[model samples]
Target: MWIQEVGEYSKKLLDKGTGEDVVTYRRVQGGEGTKSSQQRIQVNGDGTVTIPKKDADLNISIDNGEHSNYFKNEVRGGNADIVEFDVPKWFDDFLKENTIPQSGYNSNPLNQGGTAPKLVDPTKPGNSFEVPAPWVEWIEEYAKNAQIKK
Candidate 1:
């Protein structure tokens, strides 16, 4: 049986003007613990807070609530080191402005008014077809550029 003894938890405002604070907690035996601290600027008349855009020490955000446990597991395993940036107001507007219906690739041959040749299935034994001339030429050019021999 393993037991964790937590001790010495403290919270202090590092910068009261900026609403920046630090909360530190430590465990007694294994020296393992968690500290969750956040700083935000109160947006005037908006009832919103703005988190600063800076390199984080350890930041993780998940859209789905179910993934929270998984995040905790990673933190315990010392695998949670990636820092994430909270999307800004302008990013949401940009996403709305650039929104488009999902479709085939913009550079797809079919979309570009080019006929794409259908190749025979290679999984079927004894089923084969001659490679298209244009495709062969393209492969030849690609190999020449890559300096690879067939």
Candidate 2:
């Protein structure tokens, strides 16, 4: 039989100093017999994500964007990644602020938005990624940034 192990997750309404809502997630390694290490990730108000055991300042906006586009293409093996339907208003605004403008070209009617899905709340319930634990930073970034209230 094939099985995978997963860690637990919890959401905190207020951070110690920032008082932003944070989602803390624990991730498991492999299978039942495999040894696992717990990692903590935090998203700063500065738009940088830090993972203790992994690299710090991982802004996976692109990663989340790519995963969000999985269904439109389906090249990836597993199901489509999770798309945030409960996106907060400010987070939506941030995405709007960061829109990579299409400067050149455009005479034809073919070129348009980038491959990644537009950063916005999905019309229907959607998945961002299959494994949420590894993407804890993104979750918190999206969550905290939404509540940060520029």
Candidate 3:
């Protein structure tokens, strides 16, 4: 069951972008009557998943720009950046079990602040602004339901 869940979650992240990635953080369990398990999966540069000490939280971010020609053009010109995913035990095991590629794992260019050409607005003619629809959607969905334990 855990394996299947991890696979599905990982697939969703990959579907978002070729250069996209994910991070999984496991929380140490404690206390009586509390499940001795908790986990979080963050889609670097976009969304996050927090499996509270009890319930699981899923946050998915889809980058519409990835589906756009402009983004691909930037990648071709070496101006495109890649997001990273920190492998979780479940995901790691799944990768090993399926023998899938692990090239993108732990490779987050955005976190490293790698240099990439800023997305330009073609319609604006000389405007060097890029729409962050992917991050926007991620924030809208994840931020709204995120549990803020302040």
What's the candidate order when arranged by decreasing lDDT? 2, 3, 1
TM-score of each: 0.19, 0.25, 0.20
* Model 1: per-residue Cα lDDT over 5-86, one tens digit each: 0001112224333443422111111112553233212122322223243222212221222232333343333332222122
Q: Which ranges in model 2 have alpha carbons more than 4 Å from their true place?
A: 1-73, 79-85, 102-139, 142-150
Candidate 1 residue 87 Cα shift, in angstroms, is 7.6
Ranking 2 against 3 by TM-score, winner: 2
* 56-116: candidate 2 lDDT, tens digit per residue: 2222222223333433333322322222212233343333333332333234232232222
Q: Write the per-residue lDDT of candidate 3 for residues 1-150, one digit (tens) a residue.
A: 522433343323222333434322111122123321222322323344332222222222112222223322332233322222333334334332332112342354532232211222324211122112332233233331122110
Worst 10 residues of 3 by lDDT: 23-32
Q: Of the candidates shown, which would achieve the greatest TM-score relative to the real structure?
A: 2
Best candidate, lDDT-wise? Answer: 2
Candidate 3 CA-lDDT value: 0.27
Q: Candidate 1 versus the native: TM-score?
A: 0.19
Residue 19 local lDDT, model 3: 42
